[model samples]
Structures are given as C-alpha cells and as structure tokens.
Target: MDTQIVRCRECPLQGCDTFRPLSEDKLEYLESFKQGEAVFRKGEMIMSQGGKAPHLHTVLSGMLIRYRSLDDGRRQIVNFMFPGDLLGLQGAFDDDLSHSVEALIDARLCVFPRNDFHRLMGAHPRLGYDLVWLAAKEETALEGHLVSVGQRTARERVTYLAVWLLDRALATGVADDSNRLELPITQAQIADMLGLSLVHTNRTLKSLREEGLVDWAPGNLSVPDMDKACKFAQYTQIDSKRPFI
Candidate 1:
C-alpha cells in the first residue's frame, strides 16, 4: 500500500469503531495529510510536556511511550503504545500536554492536524463519541499499569503485562485463543513498561515458564490457553462498547 493511504489501508485503527468512527471517504481524506514517513526517532520527543497540541497521532507500527520524568531524571512510563494506539487525545481541550510522547522504536504515525481533526469531529459526531471512548480506554490502560506497579508481585506483574498484550492483540484481531502471536519487543522494554527490574523480570518469566502459563520463543510467545493465562494473572474481563462492527 502507498504510505499516504495508510489510514485508509494499513492502519489497524481505521476499522476500530471505538477509536475511528469516520466513513471511508473521511478516513481516506484524513490519511492524505499523513505524509507517510517516520514521524520521530526513538527518544526524540514527539510532543513535549506543556507543549500546545498540534496533531493527533495514530500509531501505524512500532511502539511509543507516554512518560513523565522527575526532576532527578527518574522516569515512569505511564503507557506503552501498540499498533493501533492514539496519542494526544487524552488531554485537555485547551491545555498543554501533560506528558511527553516518545517513540520506543522506529515508529510511523498518521498525523491529523488538530484543526482538521476538530472539523472532522464536528462533521461526524460519532467521531467525537469515539474519541471520548478512546480517551477512556487510555485512562483504563493507565489504571491497569498503576495497579501492576502498586499491587502485583513480580511474577504477577509479568503475568499482568503478558496477559495485557495477549488480550489487546486478540481484541484487535491480531491473535487468538491459541495464544500464538508476534512479539517484537525485548525483555528490557517489558520491564520498563511493567515497572520491574531486569533481574525481577527474568525471574518472573522463569516462574511463568515453570508453571506452564506461557512460553517464550524467538520473536514470539505461546499462551497455550488464554483463559488459563488470564486466570493466572487474575485478569478480569471489562465490558466496553463494541467499537468495530
């Protein structure tokens, strides 16, 4: 597919009725502004804290991190972006950004200029409704991360993170009950996202392997039975509106 047509073609999010409620014509139009290039380099700030919002970005590939750094240089990653995640829509209607968005890998983004985006939302009320839902989902994901950091044991934290990805991948139709899925991320990245030390992450993975909850191989993972894995992680299903028909 041509890079400029990504929103209409390869955007995993274009069909996600929750995040995208625009018609194909609108999507095609929205995608045309995207320019089809690597938006930012890893560690380069896409949107800095306190910066005025300009564009709403949809992750087309690779991962991004939403993080805030302390005065002492300590950082906490609030959320990790996946294939279909949205950035810049979780903030105030008129305030500056509260956190910085950085690519964790070489990532591509479909950029929607804020002015045009607002016009689109006005023209399609369903798009506005869907944006609200997407923001709520980001909040929910942040809450989940908070719980993992605050309450879960090391093993449970690993389980929580793994189960999180498995569920997300399946929900997005990228994986299934078989737990067969692509995993292009590293253990260090997983630790950062889960708020775990590298050693602790290894221990947790070893424990999960011993208990047969999941298996990790080169470039992928096998969950065997997603339900069983979810049970191990104490995962509970949340009900949300079906965003994609």
Candidate 2:
C-alpha cells in the first residue's frame, strides 16, 4: 500500500470550523516536527494500554475506539475517535498510556515524536490552546457516556448512541445531508459500550427497528427520522461546535 503524505495546510478536515488553522510559521514548524504517517488495518491496536507512548497521533482518516480492560478481562470502550481527533496526549503528560486505542476500520495517522510535540505546544501558544480545548471536549463526551451507561435503559442507551454517532458524523463532514450513516461496529461492541450483554443489545436494537426509530444493517446504521429517534431516547439535542485538532 502506498502511504498518503499528510500536509497540515492541505488537510481535508481544515474546513471544519471547529478546528482553527495554524499560522504559516506554526504549520511549517509542525511539518518539520512530523515524523511520518502510519497505517493500521481494522481491529489492529493503534496504541496499547501500559505501553510506551513515544509519539502523539492525529487521526487523518477512519474511526478508532479508546478502551480499557479490567483485570477479569472485561473491556469497556471509553470513546470513539473520528478524523481530526488527537491521541496520546494523556501519555504525553503522564509518560505512559493508561488506555488502549484500536482501529475500528483501516486507519491512517500523522505522528509527532513526543518530545517534539511538547516543544510545538510550548512554542505555539495558539496550538496549546487548541489542545486544551480538545481535552475539555473529550472530558464532556466521557461524562455523557457515563450518564448513558449508568442511568439509561438499554433501549434508550442504544438510541442515544445511534443519534450521537450520526450527529458526530455530520459534524465531521463525513456524511452528507442525509440522515443515513455507516457505523462499522458490531453488536458486541455496542453491548460493550452500553454495559449490556450481547443478547440484550440485539434485543434492544430489534425494538428500535420495530418502533421505526432506526435501521441497522451489518455495517450501516441510519435514523429514518432524527427527531423521532431523539424522542425515543429522551435526548435533548445540543448543537455544540466541535474543534478539529
């Protein structure tokens, strides 16, 4: 496979309003600091829990999942990372990765050596601000996920997740004006995310389909009516601007 060269100024996601573009000098400096790009196949581990995090990554394409495993071998997915999401920042601060990141599909990443990443942030205050903003956004997503898993019913949990993914896809410019979106995850992964068993997850999805709230195929999930799906999930839609890092 040929490696696709990633240039900061020519990034396809630069059009995302949430991501502020770096100045010419900063962009050039970042380009100099970049080591290269790495590609991973679906189901491959991008970064492992407890492993050395030598570099920070910017997701250039494809989806990823951040997760942690319990001593008993149960895994809880913490979040789904789309394009423009930053990875290994936590390790940049703590010197090791606390959770693992896996590619949900074939993925590509722009890599920056950890030391150079710190230098870039320090020398460019605007970039530093962007990093902080990204971190806060991630924190907010975690809080929402916690509430969904802890307090929501199985059906509601699934509904909210579907809506959330669709919204995210739209915000990131991956999907068009259509309500349909492709979700490549399995029911088992959804069960892991919602803290439910595989059987229960299947049943809840069936209920949603029966109610005309959603349509789920093997690798695609679509909401026929976004408003109705939100109502079924008891979700109040929030239109927050997302940053592209």
Best by TM-score: 2
Cα RMSD of all models vs. native, in order, equals 3.9, 2.0
Judge candidate 1 against the unseen true structure and give its global Cα lDDT, from 0 to 1.
0.68
Query: For each candidate, what TM-score against the reference?
Result: 0.77, 0.92
TM-score of candidate 1 on Cα atoms, chains taken together: 0.77
lDDT of 1 by residue, 79-160 (tens): 7776666777744366788788887666777666665666767766775676677777788888888888899888777777
Which runs in model 2 stand beyond 4 Å of their true positions?
A: 1-3, 234-240
Model 1's number of clashes is 1
For model 2, residues 1-245, the per-residue Cα lDDT tens digits are 22567787887777775455566887787778778889989999988998878788888888899999988989999899888789999878766787899999888888888866668777887777777888888898888789999999998889988887887777776666598877688998998998999999989889889988877767998899999898877776647664554
